[model samples]
Target chain A: GAGVSQSPSNKVTEKGKDVELRCDPISGHTALYWYRQSLGQGLEFLIYFQGNSAPDKSGLPSDRFSAERTGGSVSTLTIQRTQQEDSAVYLCASSLWGRNTEAFFGQGTRLTVV
Target chain B: GIQVEQSPPDLILQEGANSTLRCNFSDSVNNLQWFHQNPWGQLINLFYIPSGTKQNGRLSATTVATERYSLLYISSSQTTDSGVYFCAVDHYNNNDMRFGAGTRLTVKP
Candidate 1:
């Protein structure tokens, strides 16, 4: 089975620009999540979606950061007006459900704000 | 919100040796997971053991939910085991998981 996959493994953008990172979860896995990792901040959740229910966007750092999951399989994380501090590796993960389940992860999109 | 703490912070071991990593959480959790982030920035799920013990080849994990801690064991370690190991726990109904600082492991031949 294919594991979780992300697009644009690396992205470099100017400050105040918008960037979108995509994630494809594993087949039959309805639970998808996004996280960010950097030298200053450890791994932190960004959002999670279960089926079509409203996503848990509590982890999003600011209003400029948003994510959407479509068809309950693919998810896109968008960072609007990116800043230098936003530079980090955005990771995607998926599990079977919100219950006790193992989440598979993607290689992640390394975003660098210049 | 939940707080997770990993012990040792860093460890160095020779090939064929054994090591144990620990994770402690501040609150009760409904789910707990272990992950390994390689140098390539790939997050690999190691286990989803909220409770009990599970073993995969030379790697094993034990979670004592009552104690609010988990242990990951690696026996006969290899150079490939070098990486940062993290323990993340999701507080009940939080929908978001909190991760520990992680324990860095260095395997030397």
Candidate 2:
């Protein structure tokens, strides 16, 4: 709608349980990106979706992390069998295009795996 | 893959003072952006300068693409300006944005 919106601002999950984080990009934005930030760390690239193109998942740390964008608007990141290390803030951002454009970020989802 | 490095890992300034942050990249980039991460962990876009310079209120930024570096200037800093500043870049051939470790700014009253 206005800016990027992320669901479940904060989540607490069991060590081995799977968790899903959602993102709603701004209207008509064609590029969406997912990033992870650990405490006192820089933002780490996770995945990127540009329009209808195949997603770039090169930054995904492991097979346990996967994401999907529906209709090029909303995206969901699924972390399977979450580990304690997966606990961090997941941030979503969107831009009119992937290059030469400014990206707007959401408030992020804080995931805590115990 | 491009490498981004931000200098002066930490900075502390009195309100109304001025400060400058630096970001250096390893390769040519088509997109470069500056962001401010507030206390709540929200990223606020500051500048989208791949080259040249841009200004917004009390803040301004300059990028020398030829030199593979960018500079952020904060004039008249305020307590509310306390946060972490990051600079990100996208390689000319790729869209993946790489970010610097960031410079933490603490503006004191």
Candidate 3:
């Protein structure tokens, strides 16, 4: 992929339903990140992966929010028993192996919990 | 956790005017980036400046890592530039990349 790619660009789910968001990062990139942005809010870090291991999960808001990356290439974010307050945009980004590199973002998934 | 702060929470300017946005961090960072979120909600990377300065067309950025602050300058702004600009940073040896509240700019025609 030329850039980070996210699936289900828009999702409308009922309360208590489960939703899964996917991200396919650029080729050969080693670091991946997940973030959430509420309407008119700044990006909030959710999780970060260096390869298949998530080194930072301090930002995941609650137990219902979880994410996993496989093969060090694709990642999935799963929200269980979603709530109305969960409606927001989920963004994924990828960068090179180290902390000093630049990161690129995906188009994001807009989840609307109705 | 590192605290990131952006000044002038909101600004409105006429077309062709220039503006500067500032971002301050609570700790030294290994990576700093500027992003622009357009009206349709697309986040575009503007700069990946952790130190020194860089420019592209009408936009330029400067980050003084020693001072823990960065500045983004928009020259001859246009109506198309109306959107939210964000500054994100990753602290040294930390995997979390935190963002400031952002500076929302409105360029009037």
* Interface CA RMSD of each prediction in angstroms: 1.4, 0.8, 1.1
TM-score of structure candidate 3 = 0.97
DockQ category of candidate 3: medium
- Candidate scoring better on lDDT of 1 and 2: 2
- In candidate 2, which residue pairs clash? none
Candidate 2 interface RMS: 0.8
Best of the candidates, DockQ: 2
TM-scores, each model vs. reference:
0.95, 0.98, 0.97
lDDT per residue as tens, model 1, B5-107: 9998999999999999999998888889999888777778899899999999999999999999999999999999999999998788578678899999999
Q: Which ten residues in a row have the lowest lDDT in candidate 2 chain B?
A: B89-98
| lDDT string, candidate 1, A28-71, tens digits | 99899898998645788889899878888888889999999888
Candidate 1 local Cα displacement, residue B29, angstroms: 1.9
* Model 1 lDDT, full chain set: 0.89
Q: What C-alpha lDDT do the candidate models reach, one value each?
A: 0.89, 0.96, 0.92
Please, what are the lDDT tens digits per residue for candidate 2 over residues A1-114?
A: 989999999999999999999999999999999999999999999999999999999999999999999998999999999999999999999999888888999999999999
lDDT of 3: 0.92
Off by over 4 Å in 3: none
Number of the predicted model whose lDDT against the real structure is largest: 2
Quality of model 2 by C-alpha lDDT? 0.96
* Higher-lDDT candidate of 2 and 3: 2
